[model samples]
Target: MKIYITSLLALLFSLVLNAQNLEKYEEMPEVDGVYITQNMFELLSKIDVESDDPEEQNFVELIKNLKGIKVLTTTNVEVGSQMKTDVNSYVSSENLSELMRVKKEGKFLKFYSKPGSTDQKVSQLFMFMIDEDTSEKRFVVLSIIGDIDLSEIGQMAGELKGVPGAEELKNIKDEK
Candidate 1:
């Protein structure tokens, strides 16, 4: 019984630590971060939308299952380097599989995901991007947790317009 309790507590602690991978960057002056909680998603799902379009309906359904989203961006060279390392570590530690990689318009984007309920769905989507066009290089990390439908990811990107590196989500091709 004692062993069981200890194991359960350890599991909960690791889950929390994994969830807060990007939290440290939130308070840093050099990092721009945005965190949207599960409650916000719940509220968004409750909004009444009288749309007959299948695509629109699918978008709503997608939003309903989302738990949260965390975004961290940095233009400082040092911070950007650190973010790259942290993103790599997070991906490996979380055992996320590489979904895709895109390099276009002076930006390099890499996506990773954790398995979901179905082949077309993902429990978590993680993105890391580096922009080399500007004099000051920019790095971005975006983590989304939920039962996400890969087919509707483009809609998610549209909804999150202006979020750094979100536009690249449209490029994801659900290959197997």
Candidate 2:
């Protein structure tokens, strides 16, 4: 019985990591500012250049690599200053929290929503990244925070690949 239980647990853990294959990623050519891998779509939805905060500054460096960024929201963040307000509003309104961070190491910034909330069991820390060499940005790393629908992020990512820019975002984003 012990052997069976241990094996089952191990199998389950393996299934989790094997969820998304990051290497199989391809940038969407038709969409100017959107790119998708087997799991998530990294996009420069908008650009803000006014803020001096380390996080925002790092975010700018990371996203500069994205080909073309389109703003789905009605936000008018023409410069970095407006982007500062926009990012701050997103963090607060969305209940998004910065958990694990990887800014200088690469172009990926990760944040997660607390688990056990009214939201679905999809507590994934999403990373926003940019390739320094190529200046291409990708939403590439996801770490599990707690128990939830682990596959939710992957499904969302896959959806982004199929749809266009903001239209795809509206369909995949869990606004709640």
* Estimated TM-score for each candidate: 0.86, 0.29
TM-score leader: 1
Worst 10 residues of 2 by lDDT: 68-77
Tell me the alpha-carbon RMSD of every candidate.
2.7, 17.8
Instruction: Pull out the clashing pairs in model 2.
Output: 33-68, 48-80, 49-79, 49-80, 50-80, 50-81, 65-135, 107-129, 121-148, 121-149
State the local distance difference test value for candidate 2. Answer: 0.37
lDDT of each: 0.84, 0.37
In candidate 2 the C-alpha lDDT for residue 39 amounts to: 24
lDDT by residue for model 1 over 28-144, one digit each (tens)?
999888889889989988898898998888888988999989888889999889888778877887899998888988889999999999988899998999999778789988888
Clashes found in each candidate (C-alpha, N, C closer than 3 A):
0, 10
lDDT of 2 by residue, 86-126 (tens): 34454455466654444453443434444543455434343
- TM-score, structure 1 vs. true: 0.86
After best superposition, candidate 2 residue 2: deviation in angstroms?
63
